[model samples]
Target: MISANKLAGASSSDKYRQIHDAFEKTGRHWLYNATVGAGLPVNHTVRDLIDSGDTILALSGIFSGTLSWLFLQFDGTVPFTDLVDQAWQQGLTEPDPRVDLSGKDVMRKLVILAREAGYDIEPDQGARGVAGAGALRRRVRRSLL
Candidate 1:
């Protein structure tokens, strides 16, 4: 399934799930690499690394161009929500701005990465609570340092 849309994850409501499911199940090999790129096709790289017996600790990158630009424009001078509103007004966000605000795209890509990394992580299971999120933020920040 050559899909650029954010519908490849395990969403039963998603019509294209069958195509992506096939690619995930039987190594159909025709899957289109979309999202979660780190200068290259990161999903394919993760799959390749897994196939070659490499362990994937974490997959990280700026998946959404709009989100990346929004972060760049944020310097705390204006409320972050105000920046999001501005971006939405400028048509830089999805038709439903909540999708971007909720990290919908990024969460879906995270699930895909988890599956490729050989973890049976479902979309719902990918959601970490506030406390877990704080620890994850700390870990990522320390890694950068």
Candidate 2:
């Protein structure tokens, strides 16, 4: 999977090697758009630019879930907490918004982007307790950092 986090301590060459090894198991036919990127078509375009030897000084955009949540917000008159809960229910947030809210999502996204830009980044430990929410908002708040 094109994870939103990089395997820490791995160099650029090492990242590519790891990526190749991980994909080799699924068979050669299973080609992931590694050249592309995380959110969607934009990643692909960025990858194309990189492949063409264009120097990518900086790149930024909203993550997929953030976009999803923004779209969801306009569809109803739900309260902020309820809208956030709905976003979670709809799987728009990263496993848990508590994690997203606590800055883990940003950390992971940054790490992934930095890795893509040829930097050696460390992994984050932000999603450590995003569990046992028991199908309720209480669980989400409890899991926040």
> Candidate 2 residues 1-145, lDDT tens each?
4443323322244665576676788665323333223435654565577778877787666544554465557543555677777778887666767766665555555555555565555554324533653565575456553
Most lDDT-accurate candidate: 1
What local distance difference test score does each model get?
0.70, 0.54
Q: How accurate locally is residue 105 in candidate 1, as Cα lDDT from 0 to 100?
A: 68
Please estimate how well model 1 matches the true structure, expressed as its whole-model Cα lDDT: 0.70
Query: Which stretches of model 2 miss by more than 4 angstroms?
Result: 1-39, 67-79, 124-145
Q: Kindly give the stretch of ten consecutive residues in candidate 1 with the minimal lDDT sum.
A: 8-17
- Clash counts for the predictions, in order: 0, 2
* Number of clashing residue pairs, candidate 1: 0
